[model samples]
Target: MARSKKYFNPFKPSAGAEPPRIIGRDQVVLDFVGALEGGVGAPARLMRVTGPRGSGKTVLLTDLGSRAQDIGWNVVNITAGINMLDDLIHELSPDSSVDSLSVAGNAAIASGEAVMKVKHPNLRALMKRCCGKSKGLVITIDEVQDAPIEAMQLIAGSVQHLIREKKDISLVFAGLPMGVMDLINGKALTFLRRAQSEELDFISLIEVRLSFRDGFAVSGLILRDEQLEMMARATAGYAYLIQLIGYYVWRFADLHRARSMEVSDEDVRLGIENAMTRFHEVVHEPAISRVTKGAMEYLVAMAQEGERASTADVAKRMGREPKATSSFRRSLIQREVIQSPVRGYVEFSVPFLREYVLENADELLDRY
Candidate 1:
């Protein structure tokens, strides 16, 4: 009913927070529309997106759900964890609740679902009813990596059954690249294996530049073309980094430059430094914590080298023979932590991961 007051930070850096304008993701939205309009059994109806942390998987799902809502579709978005199946059922249930349904952190379910009734139903039954009540039904799951296997199986199986019966439904989900593969490859999720899969990565630098221009103009914050280019390059085309840099830059201009709202070259520098500090905490630590000790050693060894880490050199650094390190290399590749650019060399797949490893290698190498 009312708009919030404007804040200096025009960028929304928090995960899943929709930015004023989504950039470089036109194809995803286009494909979603195509799939939605194409009806059941459309390859895009069952879409799975995979990406490393901070690569905008959640944001993409949020965008798609909003688009579906705009077009008379009943969109239900849920995160994968705990009682995710129950949560989905609750949303589709009458009154957005069933006396028997179990959910957590969903107080607004009743207000949002706009439903009325007292009976709880199974996923298939509830979804079919929801589909019947809407022009179309869209169920989007985020962080699919953490989805309980049995719940995921049930959801997938229900969607599969619904599809066979020709109910207008769509199932789109996103997760880290590694976990998505593991989930789909599980025993009961064979249907997921055939879904249209997408891997998100860096967006174009030009798009980031344009976004920066628009975000800056909103607050009358000015950066010359050269300075804007420098700031854009520092982001390396990562979506989170773009938000972080813009947020910090805005903050610095807001607090430090009270007299002038303009952004200077030095502001970009300090902003990036602070942004990286936040990035390390929010993105790097959790990501690296999940890597195995042996993989850390391999990554640390690779980080020790400036660029294009040679297998032989990495093995030497890890105090292992070249042949003995192949497993670690393959493991990292499969997990999308690293990539083999050339036959003999590897590199970090995520931007600045190598730098982070190098800066903290003494503590990271071989750490459990």
Candidate 2:
């Protein structure tokens, strides 16, 4: 007899990859749809989504874009970078007109006639023409923090201009908290300051449990309530981690079945351990690497404390003045690496980060 193939992994571990079902964020999705239906000048049309690395900001943007497309609206999705503005203009430009432009150079258009000149098409004019055909245009920019200020300003200016002209246009930006704050504080993009901001927070444990249960049922697996809760708690409501846990646990159960053995708590425990390792390697390590040396020192000191660290205690541990420590604290909080639960106490925003830091303390502290 041939052995059955391993159970298919339904969960997606890739960044920005949409899952079979979005567990949380139902209200935000609804609000976005409402804004699209509301037409021009809706407050929800302009939004900034901020979150940590695994908080699903990109996925949320994709979800919103999909909804917009379903209603016959044009959606332009771009990642923020040096060429973001150019890409946006190209995407919005008339297909035939854009095709006439050379790959090595831009063509100038005057009196509806093309001339050989490297120039960007007027986004405002292109958008106006687009609005004539489609219901509206939704521009979704991911990784907003990485884009240059000039690029951001250009996109924001065009969106603001179109909005004032009563054109059906919407803009959604997704980035880290610090980047979002910088964009808001830019004098040229003051309009974005008034835009709706959605900070992606941890999903509720109850919802996490329910999603797992439903996902397992669809995969022909039976997960007891206790097992579902255990999986949810292990993920701590982090979106990416939730998928990781489910993927590994499903594989574990499949392996047990292949061996003619019942899936037990041991399989769950092993799966949780595997998921934790991947989270540290994929999310925690990369996130910490980008932080400033002083900020990392502060984080290392917090890890040493093994729990929430107070401003006074961390300052003392770092042997730095409280004022100096405060600066690092604010930066980390803005990055969503840590959060202040109370007046002066700070802890890692994601569960198990402290343990990850402790395990890799030497490697992490070496940079500082």
Candidate 3:
């Protein structure tokens, strides 16, 4: 009997899962690392990462946190929620004694001959103790827009205090563009307006091709240049689709082969179809359901116009003045549903959204 061959799929399609290689984010990663090295008061120390769904904002945050840890900084990762502040406190100060530092009223507190009145312990002091020998503290919050305003305020206040004290600490927040904007616009988080904002865009085709080639080769499969190009084009620069396409294509190839081998065009086609189906079910449906009526109308008009549509064209199709459609256009852009590539042209930010809208337009328009 022949021995069975071992197979490993390197692509990860789950949310927040680190990819085998992070393509097209090298500059962002480098800037984050440089900020960590730059120490206290670096603008990049406070970062806000925004992108459309499946754009890998969480992955980028996770990778940056890992880089901080590797450089001797203490990292705490948490999702933005009602208990975000409490979670941060617990992560920074695990001991009960740290809680006692939050005494009421004006009480003189002495720490190594440095005396200060205690109103609350504050995150700064806790972080100071926690990062005794470490370079600093890095706190990453995902889905920041979902966090309660009170929690966001508390975090912002605490971070501001820490910054004023000149303690080494950094904060990174990842969320959708509008959500991030909402968080920043909060009354207490005015300081966040100054944060280094990084809006993640689509990955380049060249980079996607390189990722597929290198990723498959390491897994003991060879993808021909044309096959690689096909796969890359199918991904349409969306980070999640890249992994989804790769995962299915790799599996398709593996099932057809008894051992490691090359990926065929047939496998690529099936994989692309499967990936697109998943994309519609997972990304497109929910996004469409949440959009406003006006935004939906704009999207339908754009879908009818093909890949790239002008604002004037969309306005004409809607039978409304261009000025009348500006609000809807802005809303769509803020939602990351569409992007303006230039002054007058707008296109769906995600790949296949146009096709998705077109195929379902009859039903969608009926409901609308």
Candidate 4:
């Protein structure tokens, strides 16, 4: 028999990069495919795949799209967050009735409108007819939450019309938590309710309070249970943090030709330190406006303390009463620098933000 090759991975998730095949999300993929196959009731399904940043949303969507193609369904992917539908429509098929189904059906749909108009009519009609057939069509929207309200409304309207017409079409939207919230609040709610909303919950690592364990485990990067736990604790289950640690450990192991099966505590420590250096570079490199910087610093402080800070507390920390702090806080929240968990509790949601802040608290405070 041929010798078994050693496949060691450091960075657990290859989001932008394509994987040979999906591993862990088998059930999720099956559920999505089943919906596409009309395995339940309607072949048309809308699912919002959500998780924290770097939680493998893009990878999952890409894999699902590939799977959809393998089964003969035409797949149309639009990065709604980046471009509006008008831009997308113009890019896909120019010089055609925007709603003619045949304009979107040509084999070279990715190209000109002549073949598309003859084959597929409009985007909505083409997608509906394609989805109705044995070869279903799927549309996936990446970073869907950041999509403008107008785009969201337009997509929702299309989906609603399609469903009402009982056409065969399905959609998968992936984005940060905000994207899900936006859909629920907007006119999309009518469509969203009929669709399954799956929150890609983070891998729970209680000891490290993070999901690194699953990250390494799924990547086939074996580590001693204790060592893995330590690493998990340090990173607190953050997707990027886990990948950062894994990247370092794999690099160090490969460089030193050390044991591959079990990563050591020392290895974990070194990896974290290296990640911290990279984090520090990014955090300190940009000197934004004073107000933005001050608000960020204050939020960082709250994260380090592991407690939510009220507007009043935030004001006090920055040596400004509620008024100035309130204005700055609103901007920060809008920028996703801080989030309100409930009514009064404002907290930082980014992973390892506390540790980064504690390390540079003195310097950050000085700036303010």
Off by over 4 Å in 4: 1-15, 18-27, 39-44, 70-72, 81-121, 132-134, 187-190, 206-222, 258-262, 276-291, 300-305, 365-368
lDDT of 4 by residue, 1-368 (tens): 97755556635434455444433466788887777777334533688887766566787888888888888777777786545565445534555334432212212212222222233255455456556665655778888777775555555556666666676666788877775676657643455545566666554566232244555565455567777666666555554455666677655544444345455667777887886566445432232234456576666556554656776676666677677667666766655556788876687655555566666667666775
lDDT of 2 by residue, 78-188 (tens): 999876756777788734243222221111111121232235456566767777778888989999988876566656766777787899998899998877898778646
* lDDT tens digits, residue span 309-356, model 3: 989999999999999999999988877788898999899877788999
Instruction: Return the lDDT, model 4, position 309.
Output: 71
Evaluate model 2: give its lDDT.
0.80
Candidate 1 or 4, higher TM-score?
Answer: 1
TM-score of each: 0.85, 0.86, 0.84, 0.73
Clashing pairs in 1: 95-115
lDDT of each: 0.82, 0.80, 0.82, 0.60
Please give the RMSD of candidate 4 to the true structure: 6.8
Q: Which 10 consecutive positions of candidate 2 have the poorest summed lDDT?
A: 104-113
TM-score of 2: 0.86
Compared with the true structure, model 1 gives a TM-score of: 0.85
By TM-score: ranked, best first:
2, 1, 3, 4
